[model samples]
Target: MAATKKGNTEQIHDLLYQALETEIGGVGVYTTALTCAVNDDLRKEWQGYLDETKTHKQVLLTVFEELGLDPAAAVPSRKIVKHHADGLVAAMEMAKKGGDPSAAQIVAGECVVLAETKDHQNWELIGLVADKLSGAEAATLKKAYEAVEKDEDHHLYHTMGWTRELWIEALGFPAVLPPPEEVKKVETAIGASRAEHARDDMLKHPR
Candidate 1:
């Protein structure tokens, strides 16, 4: 069977749907990560992100309504995104089954970072789409992007720090707990660079 072609609006709708599901999975991922996290500060941070991810889904739902897109409609691409999330969940479970609690925590951290990497890029692309739109559609997507962009940034950046620091310790290398700077809260390019520098400085005196 020939595949149905999609218009620009249809494409955007599918992308939004994909992003919506990813955010939904994000909440679960963060919740699971918190369960395995031994670091109090990291656990606290994941808890906050889990909350933000929930709100992000609501924001996307509102955007769907504004665009007259049905949130319940199934899209193939979204199924792929969901499967990826499922894979992450299974990996965490496998780690736990092995009785390696620390490995499980690291796996969860890595999964959150992976999920957020896609989530962050999705919003950035949506921002570009918003710039090309007009009137209410533009307003709706732009608002949604602005509302979640910073949180998404924090999820990707901060969790990435946790993943790295955790791995460093796992490898018997001196690692900084709670990384010198909270990279997750960083939303700007310059902020990311600063966080990198902070990590470098901390690595010199790992606890």
Candidate 2:
């Protein structure tokens, strides 16, 4: 039983470390993405997300301090996370240099979606881990998870909505700008799906 508990604790530590790395990388992704954003609405939205991402990083730093972990400790998984983030930034830079603002915007949205996917999953797992534990550890993780959960959902789902609508517009369809997710303020997977399905009606009604 002791061995099992130790293993689980180690796993949680690794997760927290990876989560911190994700937020750090997320800041970079959002920052570079803003440079590629052509739509004023999208630019404003991404700027907000960028600020939130930075705050999320600080949240994790606090978590690390509370849990007695080194936020800067060397971890193997951190390298892979950084590599993926750097790739996303590089992809956006390539698109931006292609001299097509619209195309670059699309690429940026895709990168944001990718980065937020991992980030959202990290928080979800943290919440799950918190549920299984008790005492101060659970309390700390739960607080951190709750603080960041809604933002993570919004980051992933809304960016996905934006990416899809951007692609549809690029395909020359009558795509809805700002996406239904944004207008409806979706913060869950189900809400995002509903918003996506409502797009046809939105285009028809144009509210």
Best by the TM-score measure: 2
lDDT value, residue 63 of candidate 1: 93
lDDT of 2: 0.94
TM-score of 1: 0.90
lDDT of 2 at 166: 94
Give the 10-residue window scoring lowest on summed lDDT in candidate 2. 2-11
- How well does candidate 1 score on lDDT at residue 117? 88
State the lDDT of candidate 1 residue by residue for 104-207, as single tens digits: 88998888889998999899989888887777888999999999988887788778778888999999987778864483356676777687677766667554
Which 10-residue span in candidate 1 carries the lowest summed lDDT? 1-10
What is the Å distance of residue 138 in model 2 from its true position? 0.3
Tell me, by lDDT, which candidate is best: 2
**Residue 118, candidate 2: C-alpha displacement in angstroms:** 0.4
- lDDT, each prediction: 0.83, 0.94
